[model samples]
Target chain A: MNARNCLEVLRKIKDVAFATVDEVGKPQVRIIDVMLVEGERLYFCTSRGKDFYQQLERDGNVAVTALTPEFQMVRLNGRARRLANQKEWIDRIFEENPSMNDVYPGESRYVLEPFVIDCGNVEFFDLGVTPISRESFPVGGGEVSEKGFVISDACIGCGKCLRGCPQQCIEEGTPFRIMQEHCLHCGRCFEECPVQAILRR
Target chain B: MNARNCLEVLRKIKDVAFATVDEVGKPQVRIIDVMLVEGERLYFCTSRGKDFYQQLERDGNVAVTALTPEFQMVRLNGRARRLANQKEWIDRIFEENPSMNDVYPGESRYVLEPFVIDCGNVEFFDLGVTPISRESFPVGGGEVSEKGFVISDACIGCGKCLRGCPQQCIEEGTPFRIMQEHCLHCGRCFEECPVQAILRR
Candidate 1:
């Protein structure tokens, strides 16, 4: 699917596991309530006084994974940029999420800061569907280049890269082409290329 | 309330969001199937060719979070050590998980490797419960030292720590003690301590 489909899956799974790196460089994960989805950007609020807030501040890089009821999994990896003006969005967040008032009641809501994952990589995998389909796409806007090995025209059809590919996604042609979707991007084919024709995109 | 309870929750929620660090220290998370649980140790399997396997092999540290249907969230952070001998566990994993046969049928299952999260920290939180109860404990074997600030005997009962605690878990006493269960571990008390009475436990 596309980024829009990924965002739809994320919205369906409102409660997601947000992963961040702590000071010690260890992976720290916790459940987070997704406040709202505005186009490609996903907004979430957290109290400034919590360790979760500190981790996000220290490292904007974050990953969020959510599994839908139908066993569809959507993982979004991106930098969490804090909104420049928190006051502008806090009211809208409370309006959409009325229950949040109980958590941060009245004027105390100011303690919560809103952050957005504007653009990054998004992967959608559906296990419930037959043959198990999975696709990765960029959210918001970015180069649409897939991160995998691509064989150049210099190839002599050696078939070396095909044999070395773990997923065997290489198809025979004048210059063997690597299937962008099925590729694992493990760099096996690039290493096995004798003519140095394999280029990472 | 305890490690056992946390493990119970993990078992019930078989699919969990497993987080690991990439080469650049960016957090990466994906939906992983929890193969089985042996006592306090949680076992999971992944193919050696996948980036997930490579990341775990490079860095044993990982964090897993899963949310139950009842709105209970369980987060487990620990080192994922590969089982010394894969032959002993691979077959068992396949046998236990019948659907895995479709993904890796016949001899293809050998590509999968099993790993275990032996001992680590586990936090149980239930938003469905009134007052939002939460507790952290060590799984496997270790001291149940809370990660947050602990009030030392040097506390002058100044009421400063109580005021600084975001959760308001500190109670009045000769030496104010932080209620470990409700602490967010934000280090606010440690920073606000005048006499350095709050030490991280």
Candidate 2:
């Protein structure tokens, strides 16, 4: 899909999942009500001087994920800058959500930051079957694993390792199941398991 | 920054924080290495079939934050998808990481997915600046607190709250310190504090 079409799909979706790293190298995740996407960038509002804001200040590069029940999803990567002082800009953002006015009177504690990903660099992928998908284009890195990832004794059911899996192969419950059909063997789940329950089969 | 440049920056950054929610409406946070960035999309491999992935499938809107010492940071909002059975696309993604050859070889237990955000919907901000910003248009949000947030008696000091604080205002030492200068009043520290110690005064 072209950038415009891809963006339209993203904007229509409401719920999103965002991923980022902290100074300590640990993955921190959160769910946001407002995700403002514009131009070659992604934008949002949150309390200023918060850990997430602090992290954003220290690092501009980031990844964003948005999902919808229509089986639509969007992920974007870019650099973020905080608008700790742009009232006019902040006001424009708050206008989108009247509810924000009830909570943050002046957006004082709020920060209006925009994450710009070079649209020119953006790679687009649409689920389902599409005649125009460049799915054949080499993705990025090397193969993760051909075989299914091994689940060690450390499986905690906390469900943290689930995000690392792409093929929807890792199952929860007593013993997490690795569906062979969906498994991509990326090893991301294995590496991210808090207890090291997953290993190479 | 261009997508390539943004990717380069993301690659160099060591830690990133990922945010997601469970069925119960509670937020979960973690850190991970940003696997890849495509166009306006960002990709990370997760074990298919896990709760996180399931959650992503059900709800994709998410918030991500990255922190740095240089006081530069990036926060993102977007969506995520699960690569059902696109071997060709997954293969392309795998080609980007040469290290996979040494670790997981030929194995493909992962899924390939991407996210894209609307350009016109994006907003930008900066810390130590005017506190808010948007496009060259007019906005209408109120200001957050400036006297600094409040730390209630519910202090647990799990130090978990500090993870979400951008100002590093909620210090985890002996007794946490809320630095007013850095505090943006995002109240994330307060919202995430397990004991509910932090608050907006």
Candidate 3:
């Protein structure tokens, strides 16, 4: 659907996985709560004393994703900005997430800091359906990433790639076409092509 | 526990999240199957034609993680080597994951290639317990990564870190001690130190 809807889905799956690069540039990931979602931004929080918090402060870049029981997945690659009004944000977060009160308790909650991810590309992928399905949109003026494969002019139109496609998302043409929404980006066709035509964009 | 045990947890989780750095250096992640785990290596597969395959081929580094519903987590960061015995490995993977037959059928399964993470750091974290708990081990001669913060000799042992620690993992000592196993690796203690003696490794 749209960016907001995708984020809403992630919010619904509150316990989502967040990945960030450590100081040494190694990717680190953990399960984090989606504290709140409003407008185009998704919010979450971590304690100031943890490496996760330091990682966020040092490298604002973060990737978040969650797959629902129905095989619906929402992936967001974006910037995590610490909100300015910490108290107000934390208060609102606690109000929305009452269970948090049990962990932080009253004044101790201040140790946690809130962050928002509003600018990035959001992708929705559903594996439950036949041929799969996917869509992407940008949030807060961010650019949608051009991922996956596309057939180039080098196509011999031999239909080799089409036959190998697990999703059967390739359409025959002078150069052939990959149905973006239904494609798995599995690269099965890229290798099957007699002519090196399928290119990743 | 041990590295093998951590990988076993991931294998049990099966649908784990894998993170990789794309060509642009941004983090990209998805739910991938943890096809098999024997001894010190964890196995998985992706079609050779996808960007994921290309990224792995180009970088060889990957991060794998999954959180169980009970709040236990397994995190692995390591080198992913494209196994030499591709056909044999793929066959083993398919045999271990019979449901795959429904998707690929027969010969089409050949498109998927097997990769193994035999060298890496494995971490086991259990959040379900009070004060939390964590441990790290190396896989296949890989070095165990030194992560988290360490209280240096400069520590005045003011106990500020201990008091502020959410997990109460910091113990008072000449330099104050952060019990690595119970430490959240959250930087609260690092920020609480007035003398700024805490150092992240």
TM-score of each: 0.82, 0.38, 0.92
| Residue-wise C-alpha lDDT for candidate 2, range B1-201, written one tens digit per residue | 333333334445523455665554434443444666654455565444344555566666544554333323454444555554556545655677654433234453333343322121111222323322211111112112233477765676677766655445556655577765445556666666677666654
Comparing candidate 2 with candidate 3, which one achieves the higher DockQ?
Answer: 3
CAPRI quality of model 1:
acceptable
Local distance difference test values of all predictions, in order: 0.80, 0.48, 0.85
TM-score of the A-chain for all models:
0.74, 0.55, 0.98
Q: Least accurate stretch of 10 residues (summed lDDT) in model 2 chain A?
A: A131-140
lDDT of 1 by residue, A1-201 (tens): 678768767876888999998888888898898888877889998876566888889968899998887888898988898897888789899998898765555565666789999878898767675545568888877434355568999898999878655556789998999876565555667777899998865
- Residue A179 lDDT, candidate 1, scale 0-100: 74
CA shift at A150, candidate 1, in angstroms?
6.4
- Candidate 1 stretches with Cα past 4 Å from truth are A141-179, A182-201, B142-145, B149-170, B173-177, B184-201
lDDT, candidate 1, B64-171, per-residue tens:
999998988898988898997896798998888898776665665666789998788888877775446678788886445455567889999889777655456789
* Residue-level error in angstroms, candidate 3, position B157: 4.7
Which rank order by TM-score, best down to worst?
A: 3, 1, 2
- Model 1: DockQ vs. true structure: 0.43
DockQ of each: 0.43, 0.09, 0.52
* Candidate 3: segments with Cα more than 4 A from true spot: A152-157, B152-158, B172-175
Report the C-alpha lDDT of model 3 over A57-153, residue by residue, as the tens digit: 9868888888888888788999999999999999999999998765565566788899999899998999877868999999987999778889999
Report clash pairs, candidate 3.
A49-B186, A49-B187, A49-B188, A50-B186, A50-B187, A51-B186, A187-B49, A187-B50
